[model samples]
Target: MTTLYRSLRVLTPAMSETKPSVRGFHGKTSASTDLLETVGRVFLTGRARAHDYMVHVGIGWAPARVPGFRWSAVTANVTDELVQWLVLDGYGFHQAYFHPDRYVRGQYRERRFPWPAGGPGWYVDRAIDQGIGRALWFVAGTDPAVAADLIDGFAPDRRADLYSGAGLAATYAGGVERHELELLWARAGEHRPLVAQAAAFAATARVRAGLAVPHNELATRVFCGMSVAEASEVSVRTRPSGPVGGDVPAYEVWRQRIADEFRASGRA
Candidate 1:
């Protein structure tokens, strides 16, 4: 699979360049419109109205004719309300699938803690930190320079918390349990672009397939020392079968059966 990632720093004039792309597929505006609307309703109120915000936009896709190849673009804006909404909400284009946890309504924790208390700038800064970390992980494994760039992107006081969360998120989303985060930190000097390349490809696939995209079975299996064929089969079994709401339980049963087969074959 081929994957690519690019980063652009948001500037004033550039914000106007990113009007929403024309809708694709079913002729609706791109999925981002829905996200932006939701975000605008939730946070653009009261004293927060006057705050300037930064927005990060990421696009990932596999061309229709391409099977395993993928590409991604990450763009940002300083004034785009849509971008601000995503950053503030701690959700991105892929939030439906890739967020560390599910979104819950009315779940406000006190901002007494310094970590979440940076006010309007807090979410924007967090988004920047995450964008940089993901970008670095996509391009350079755990290179020190990448880590340094992540640190430099934020205020000195916020570095530890921001990178720590970013690292944990990557480890989980990459399906690396155990010491994956530590390993990443230890290898912070290595020149491993494959990590980023794989992520770019996976991101593209996710964009094309949306929630239909299976989690990274190959990576999960590798971490668990399972065979590629076993992992592939597991993925196929887990995919939804037939139309929506049809045979959903049966699909899950098939997934379990495939898991059993992998175990019996000593491939799990």
Candidate 2:
């Protein structure tokens, strides 16, 4: 059986001991390592069936991460359906991050470690989401034209909903919300190979679309996971935006802001 398909097979209670750790909030560790191990194993194997099941689980657990709330209350609230979606969605994100070709120079690198220079796409947030989105778009067999529309539709509108609420901020931040789309695509599996191909296309599209700012220098620093302010210092022409709202500011603006706040609080 394909590694993914085999992962779809539910494990018995006896198999629990083999799973990975499922750490929770407040540094509390759960004894569910067996469950996580099984899930992780299936996830790493890259099987379509496994991905499909995981997507279902991921969706269910998604609500736990809602804004202005504690996940603790919602963690145990997970239903079997939610678990399925979470697993799938998580896997989709993982694939985008770890896919061999997507890696720097077509090589797999440990995600826990920092990426090498001249690595894959710019903007960790953009790269990760775009990769996940492309994977889902592929699984959905979305025509390039339609996929383009979908991406446009989902693109964050900083003006309209930027500071409304925590949920809105989270969505705009493009973290977990982006992963959910990936989960949906994995479940459908319209055409698997399309995932990788679409990711490449999306990366190119981002540059052309100007979603990536200050293309030359900003792209480099972002890909390396450097802060916007840091990149701006070295490249005078690159005036990047603050981590939060506001127009693109000079690097010193942020530096001074930090200094002033620290001084006022007597923490500088």
Best by lDDT: 1
Root mean square deviation (Cα) for candidate 1: 18.2
* lDDT, residue 165, model 2: 14
Q: For residues 1-268, what per-residue lDDT tens digits would candidate 1 score against the true structure?
A: 0021122212111332212222111112334234333323332221122222211232221111122222111222223332333232233222211221221111112232121122243344433334334433322232334434544454555444334333423432442333553354444322222222223223323333332123344343332243334443444544445433332333223334544554455433
Q: Which residue pairs in candidate 1 have backbone atoms (N, alpha carbon, C) closer than 3 angstroms, thus clashing?
A: 138-196, 142-188
Which candidate leads in TM-score? Answer: 1
Worst 10 residues of 1 by lDDT: 1-10
Per-candidate Cα lDDT values, in order, are 0.31, 0.29
lDDT of 1: 0.31
Error of 1 at 20 (Å): 27
In angstroms, give how far residue 206 of model 2 lies from its true place.
23
Query: lDDT by residue for model 2 over 197-242, one digit each (tens)?
Result: 2222223323333343342222222221233333223232222353
Q: Which residue window of length 10 is worst by lDDT in model 2?
A: 159-168
